[model samples]
Target: IAGRLRGLSAREARRSAEALAHELDIGPWMDRRALPEGGGLSGGIRRLTGFAMAIAAPAPLLILDEPTNDIDASRRRLLWDALRRRGDQGAGALLVTHNVAEAERIVDELVVLDRGRVVAAGSPARLRGTQDNDLRLELQLAPGAADPSELATAPPVRQRVRTGRRTLLTVAATDAARGVAWATAQREHGLLEGFTLAPATLEDAYLALTAPGAAPGSAELDPADPHQETAHV
Candidate 1:
């Protein structure tokens, strides 16, 4: 990228490359002549190398398409810090990602797309604030215990999904106190391990917008859409 952007000489490019490699934790591979065959480089390394090139380039605007792909949590944090520093230095970035949590942390504005169409656009806070009183409750049930059938049919529950031994229950915010009380009662009966209550997040908003019976402003998305959920970018 440095070469293409400014016709940097091999020596000059090497300086920028080395700096970026060190920042992204790829300094060990900087002096290597060729990547090893077969396993060559891990997917995360390859992705981070590409990012290092772009970040080291002279381009004022960085257009990244899922820049955090295949990277570990530490590398992902490094990537965010790098991009944030670039922004602080007056560079512009356009990040394309399905990771709502990442976007919430990094971007100033968000545009949600569904089937090639823009479904929603706004700052993270604005979008999150639009949702009505909704709360998410996660409960870990005791081993070998089944979730009570009545819990799913409870009046406070708007939706309930069970994964392995854990169940995620969505309820009205107004009913959150009552919901916790009910969970506490169940815990007394040895049905629950523990539980958590929290306000709706960007993920919750995304799911609601794309749910099968989504409201007028939001469109129903196909369950098969791979981009519906993603790792933090």
Candidate 2:
């Protein structure tokens, strides 16, 4: 499309399209000329295709919402690289995603909204610094290991969940070290497959800022504002 808009020959158009396919990691799938019926193309690939088409267009601004949904890790990495490159070239992109980690990685500026209101907006580092609590420790329980109840009783655990062979523990940041130490000790004793400690994230900050009972600021959210609602951009 870009080649045609720029009045390039057919050869140039093919080359341009090929280059973009490679960049978006869709080269292998390009040979499937027929569109997938009944959504046979994975949701991620469909999104990638749309993104590729949009980026290849002559638009000065691109708005993508939840661009990474259902995308595999490898392809998602490619998408991020493409977005970063576009940013480097001074393109304007407004990306909306619930994947706060991905947003943190790619966005120079972050705007967080909850219930149709902008609760926080700033750099990832700045927003992350405002998050003072809510650390999560996830334990992958080995099958037939220690009882779930025993693990749940460990220190600093505000809440716990027991699934097939996994347990999720939510804890306070002030007690994160203690919680991690306890979980690690349990792992060393052969009671778990492994454990991971997660620090407060942009998601945490967002929740904190937009949580019910949080002090109301200048009203920025409009429940009636159509644009405030979530949409594919």
Candidate 3:
């Protein structure tokens, strides 16, 4: 059944396998009929074969579910490169992954699903940029510190406090610029310690959208406004 879809005979499949081995940078294994030591070669061979078979089928669209699983980081990077190349040449791919960082790198579009429903869909930038008002700020503070209630109460901005030796502050997206400025001013005035701004990420959006029912001081999120809600827990 697979052979028919790939348009290749057994002999042709073997030849195609050789070509795929090279494409996946596993050409050294192609010369040996037997798998290599520690079973690594067999897995590599299987992955390369599947990848090659997908490419050889002349399909306009390819769907991969967790292609990077059980693969080393280097090979994972190669796989993403291959997919991106295919995408650039006008082929469409539906990639399902929990690895948001990898998805952010290669996928032009994103469909976020929650409980088998389409919760959000757009380009990566568009989806992530939806929460332009939210900012993640990391602080470096002295040990045995108290809560940041002083800073939190200064502005009318909604704040969620994560306390440790250092504090992680989540401020409203609209208040980010002003909030950060205020924090920096406090630091300069010996109120807080060192700090850095963390980049906003798809993970942030996912958490906010999927967090359980809201608690006090946190607003109930609107699914339509992907950016305004605080990530609980």
Q: Compare the candidates by lDDT and give the number of the best one.
A: 1
User: Which prediction has the highest TM-score against the true structure?
Assistant: 1
Which clashing pairs does model 3 show? Answer: 133-173, 134-173
- Model 2 earns a TM-score of 0.62
Model 2 has a clash total of 0
- Expressed as tens digits, the lDDT of each residue in 110-207 for candidate 2 is 77777786666677756553234566677888778864435345874444445567665656778788877787878777888798888645554444
Error of 1 at 15 (Å): 2.3
After superposition on all CA atoms, what RMSD does each candidate show versus the true structure?
7.2, 9.3, 6.0
Quantify all predictions' global Cα lDDT against the true fold: 0.71, 0.68, 0.62
Minimal lDDT window, size 10, model 2: 224-233
Question: The CA-based lDDT of model 2 is what?
Answer: 0.68
**Candidate 3 lDDT (Cα, whole model)?**
0.62
Error at 9, model 2, angstroms: 5.0
Give each model's clash number: 0, 0, 2
Question: Per-residue CA lDDT of candidate 1, range 1-233, in tens?
Answer: 45547777778787888778878888887665545651567788878877887877666899999999899999999999999989888899999998888998999877777666565777775555323566778888989887962445343565555667877666677778888888888878898888888875777556655555454344232234432322111
Question: Candidate 1, which segments miss by more than 4 Å at Cα?
Answer: 9-11, 34-39, 130-135, 138-176, 185-195, 216-233
